[model samples]
Target chain A: MLAKEIIKKIKDAESNITSVIFVGCGASKADLYPAKYFLEENSTKIRTSLYTANEFNYATPKAVNSNCIVITASLGGTTPETVQATSKAKSLGAYVITLTHKKDSPITKDADYVIVHGFEKSYAEKLEKMIYALQLAVEILNQFEGYANYEEMINGFNNIYDLIEKSAATVLPQAKEFANSYKDENVIYLMSSGATHKVAYSTSICLLMEMQWMNSGSFHDGEFFHGPFEIVDKDVPFILFMNEGKTRPMDSRALTFLKRFGAKTTVIDAKDFGITSVISEKVADYFSPMLISGIFRVYAEQLAIARNHPLTKRRYMWKLEY
Target chain B: MLAKEIIKKIKDAESNITSVIFVGCGASKADLYPAKYFLEENSTKIRTSLYTANEFNYATPKAVNSNCIVITASLGGTTPETVQATSKAKSLGAYVITLTHKKDSPITKDADYVIVHGFEKSYAEKLEKMIYALQLAVEILNQFEGYANYEEMINGFNNIYDLIEKSAATVLPQAKEFANSYKDENVIYLMSSGATHKVAYSTSICLLMEMQWMNSGSFHDGEFFHGPFEIVDKDVPFILFMNEGKTRPMDSRALTFLKRFGAKTTVIDAKDFGITSVISEKVADYFSPMLISGIFRVYAEQLAIARNHPLTKRRYMWKLEY
Candidate 1:
């Protein structure tokens, strides 16, 4: 849950504020894209932007405003760039809302309002926590705009979480097969649209490529047709994250193209997981990516095992300074 | 150069306008990111967004308004989604500005103002045209706000075009060496920040991966460390697009990390091309990526040739129907 101070701050600034900036580093930064998608789809009154912590630190005072709400998320609460960005946003007269696992980390020091989500030992666990934090912000903003019932939405997330956990059993077998089929292939592509855009990004960059040391190219489905589709052929393996939302048609078009080309394609459709059956149909589209992330992590884990690499293995991440 | 009617239309609505939406399909869609970056870096008065054509068509009246200007770029101007998006923007009462190669194209028919830049036979040439169109819009808006000298900027761009062309000779040898070294490898990484961010994306997806059929991963410099950095090793090759701007320090940090780790890194810096010497210092930062795009295209072509492939070759681009 968000801090009481944060809700009160949003309530106070709701009318004047025209923008919300989500700032973070690494996986934390990718998490902002979905939050951005959520806020953009829900609130037409507020503009949402995703910025990496370092970019925010440099672009501040010009990119942010006194009439803006800046949100930062760091699982460790100690990322130097994020810490600096939060301070910069505060100095620029913007409201700062920070989400971290610890109350006393460096990022918390300069945050105007801090929500401590506690820690997770694994990447997937940390990702889930970050998603919840973003989902909470979406609820708060929607409530502030008088567009939705915040309390009901929060309760609905609990049900959606349970449903996501339940979908793992159904997703695991297919994920295992996919991993077994494509494990030896050095390069793969992942495509998605709308809310699941960042999920595809993180799954490729963070989970598969980084954690497992597999190579990948991930793209938004709408942009898939322009040129990247040329790389897709019968021998190329790809994954399509299809969500039940306005962007579904775009993904469907790409999927049809991929299938028609006889490319080895994996489809992770939210509807297959019965997302609407668990969450209210009204809110299913908003929550699709969060649910998909939970379901997809199983695939990443399976892929890592199939590739014979531990997810914790790293060459330059924690092993080297650069 | 932008047509007069477009300038007059923007000047007329400049007082009421609060947002500008850049819409396109594929490479056209990715091109909007740089334009969005330019507007954000220069003008803080208006909100800017990059939307794919399909998404814009669906977002419709909710995402656009009379107070918004929608800009779409399509080289041939027959992209079905882009044409529909332009029409949809008109229907939603948003001022529509379309960039295409012909005045009578489908997109131009629905657009309030259309600027035809003539047909480009290659991706690089088309990219140059799109960048110029976006730069022209940036100048027009900044001039309308009385924050910049439009005519001087336009004249300066002429000098920049010559400088970028001059840099091609210097970049080719290294590009040829890079292509030879990595042509056999399936995957590569590209990293950049700020204005050059989209250049990295388009270069990876549109040029190397799509045209040459090489696999690549591209990340914003600020975002490279989150998780993707774990994939880097002495054996893994990466290209870093370093620009001379506010976001330079961000790229420098990543470059330091990259070099220290002994990863094979190619640094394509704006300064290396004598950008400041050719372009006015006042406008050099905004012109960095455009320069990079021009300089980088030579490498893409060289790489394509070295890999024994033609840039125009595609498996399904225009060869098949989805």
Candidate 2:
């Protein structure tokens, strides 16, 4: 089912929803973050929480109940912990919505609504999970309490994919340069703030560490001055995502420090890609992740190519009992 | 003011707090996670949110209002972002509580209640900030809805310092061994589950990276298999905190995988320190962080000694305007 249809069904059947919980694992979990951030940023009436699927299952929040909506995703819908979490949420009387690339997968078995997203079709399709999750958040707020910029948000969503494609093309040269310059680096640290923080996190763990087997980590741009900034030096490699949002100053502050320290840095700024040209400035932050996620995929792909490592290359994932 | 006194004042003056917001920066922000986790784990009535101090100041959550309690901290109470965040929360009509080691710091200016925590006096003193935060969480839940194990929680608090001393002594040999074995490692990855997850995070960013200038990262044990495990190969160093909580299985599962792959690991088990002998099994998870935080200081100190790096060593913190 489409995200709109699922939300309409929930709105028709439920009138007292008080919480929204997003649960998944790894990149799927990271994909759910924009939606969670959006909901928390826009709505004051509902509580928002995000958790890894296994943690949600093992140490479930007390807030997961009859008035909660649990939105979970797994790319193939076969992650055991996620499937179990979906079943657990359903058992606890949550309105469960599961997103996956495949239909009739185990995660969908217990979900009240199953959204079969696309990953192998096109640039826009690759972001189906994140887009749908954001749509769910936007529509929920619009239906429940009436968002002030509801029309602007919907328009941003409409133009985001095309903007992403254009942005990706614009950054290809820089992405290739990033791949070559940092090819031999042992560790690369990423930083960002606001809505795109998880984009930095997923790119660090999934793309760098998992795909390229390079040591990588991500920190909130606001958090850099606290502890992580102590590691910045003349030759340390950093990939910073500069947001075009309220927290953009945090990114700029960190960038200033990194520059002063003479750190080797590659910055992907949303503003530079003309994000505001397609997305309204009022609701641009909510759509930054889609552009950042889409553009970073190009960067990750280039890095994989430069390192002669296939993005599918994995040392232990799905190859062993673990 | 003592944490109990602060709670008493709040109990007398305010009866409509619907949310709790924890804000700080770096290790300070990481220290607040246990209390946030405990509240979410135990209470359904109170919404809990945590943010880096700057983020809270810049893009304040709409929930921060007269119906909210904002708990913020800084060690010497001089972190500009945290001080500003405290001021912002107070302006938003939140009942602001600020915790710090120093008296009359900038952060204390706008706070309704100020808690002067100890950091230099004793082993338990080192954890005063975390202890007070946890106490606040426990008291809030008990005052609002009557926690089932409130007595157990209070007893645990009373006995925690002594238990931490004993646990530190018991782990001394292992800590020294860990320092020696890992003295030359460039990067060390830490992992844990439940409340102590932030312990690993603090150890990574503050202790290892900030103090020693080593490359380090931490991840949830529940999240290790998803992406981080791919970086685990023979001789890769890891420090795993094994909890005595409901999420203990998650740690054990990751440990099993780490062992199978021959990753060099140091495991810190709260059960081994006899936490349940003093704290009840039901409330042990919330207190695991206190024990872990206190005990791991010994490990960090030993590592500093082995690496010929003092814990006070810093490149830029307080040395420059970043």
Write down the TM-score of every candidate: 0.92, 0.98
Winning model by TM-score: 2
> Please, what is the whole-model Cα lDDT of each candidate in the order they appear?
0.75, 0.88
Q: Quote the positional error of residue A243 for candidate 1 in Å.
A: 0.3
For candidate 2, the per-residue lDDT at A142 reads: 82
Candidate 2 collision pairs: none
lDDT of 2 by residue, A1-322 (tens): 2667778788888887888899999999999988988887667678788888888988998788988899999999999999999999999999999999999999999999988888986666778799999999998888886788888888888898888887777778888998999989989999999988898989888888888899987888898898999999998999998889888999999999989989999988899888888888988887888888888888888988999999999878988886
Cα-based lDDT at residue A162, candidate 1:
67
lDDT of 2: 0.88
Clashes of each: 1, 0
Model 1, which residues run further than 4 Å from truth?
A1-5, A13-15, A118-130, A136-140, A143-145, A148-155, B1-5, B118-128, B136-155
Which residue runs of candidate 2 sit more than 4 Å off their true CA positions? none
- How is the predicted docking of candidate 1 categorized under the CAPRI scheme? medium
Candidate 1 lDDT for residue B200? 89
Give per-residue CA lDDT, model 1, range B188-294, as digits (tens): 88889987887889888888777877787788988888877777777678889998877899889888887777888888899887777766766666677777887
Reference-based lDDT, residue B258, model 1: 79
TM-score of chain A of each: 0.91, 0.97
